[model samples]
Target: MTHPGKPLIEVVNLEKDYPAGAGVLQALRGVSLSIAEGEFVAIMGASGSGKSTFMNLLGCLDRPTRGSYHLDGQDVSRLSSDQLAALRNREIGFVFQGFNLLPKLSALDNVALPLMYAGTGREARRRQAQAVLERVGLGERSHHTPLQLSGGQQQRVAIARALVTHPRIIFADEPTGNLDSETSRQVMDFFSQLNREEGITLVLVTHEADIAAYARRRIRFQDGRVVEDVAQAEVAA
Candidate 1:
């Protein structure tokens, strides 16, 4: 459940545009939305509909060309690159479609990487990483390298890595895109469990209806703008 009053993410009149050879292409135009703490929100759109661009902005991976973004009440638009990096490290966790794990590193090491970068002590990082891996049901595979793990296990490690930092929000872009149907179901179930049990705000981007259905709220985009925002209760019947 969301907290009484605080919003985890807020966007106001957000816009992003790129200059082409002959003209400018707008990826997002005057989009505004807010996500409260512990909300599981899904963003859905067709190709070139600007969902990816919006996710980039929301994740602090890119800046908006116009307007403002407040993440956990901090004005992200006003932050410098260094400050943005710090904020990202401190507040955001990312799970991508591809399990971008280091081939040479063991699952535990991969999970510990973020905390290590945050200047955490080695022992503490290892302990936290191990706890997260166990939480994600990957404790038995902690020492295995990516190549040695199944796709689902690898993705679990990726999720463990993301959660080890104890982020305020988790941004998952097609997290189940590469998994088999059963694995996808498993992963989605884990996401649901995390949201319900841990109160982590989840933002998922996907093209699949079934995947989007896992989220409590859905937002659809078209021509660089939100065309619909519906609660799952409304969608079910």
Candidate 2:
């Protein structure tokens, strides 16, 4: 998990553009940075600040229109669509504000979805999913549906789903947005625990400063560019 000086993500002159009527809207302007393995980073900005776009590119959910991205020493910008999909699935896990769980599936099944897509056998998938659910303190809830769980429990399930694949990195976008203040604290505490104990690299995106305070380093964006990047003391619970 810890690679000393090795960077898990490196981008040079990263840029992204969107087409507007009769013109182009530049969402990112030559942003460049590197994130080391086992580091915890937070990306912060207001609406239209381009942090979301930057995260999309970093998460391998979207490609940059200009500039190069190197992930784990591989130039992802040069990969074909299928290759990119495969790499993303193998290297990254995603947690979202919406939970994004299937309504009809049990918690275990929802957590095992990535394994299912990766062609894991039914029994093996169930076993792995149940293990991860237990790791997240949801072992007894594996048979419950999302609708039956509390918001915090649902988020824990999402986190379990992200961890089931044993990915090298996790990308979380507003993961605590839907939870109550106390629940948000609990979720953030869990994230911090993962970073400190397991050394799982984490990149989180949020507009709230309190949420960003949970991270060891903070990167702030303004008008499509990173205005600041600094290391800070993490909030100790």
User: Candidate 2 on 90-181: residue-level lDDT in tens?
Assistant: 78889999999998999999999988877889999999999999999999999999999999999999999999888889999999999999
Runs off by more than 4 Å, candidate 1: 1-5, 234-237
Model 2 lDDT at residue 145? 98
lDDT of 1 at 186: 91
Report, for every candidate in turn, its global Cα lDDT versus the true structure.
0.91, 0.92
Task: Quote the positional error of residue 46 for candidate 2 in Å.
Answer: 0.5
Alpha-carbon deviation at 160 in model 1, angstroms: 0.4
- lDDT per residue as tens, model 1, 47-66: 89999999999999999999
Best by TM-score: 2
Pairs that collide in candidate 2 are: none
Of the candidates shown, which would achieve the greatest lDDT relative to the real structure? 2
Q: Which residue pairs show backbone clashes in model 1?
A: none
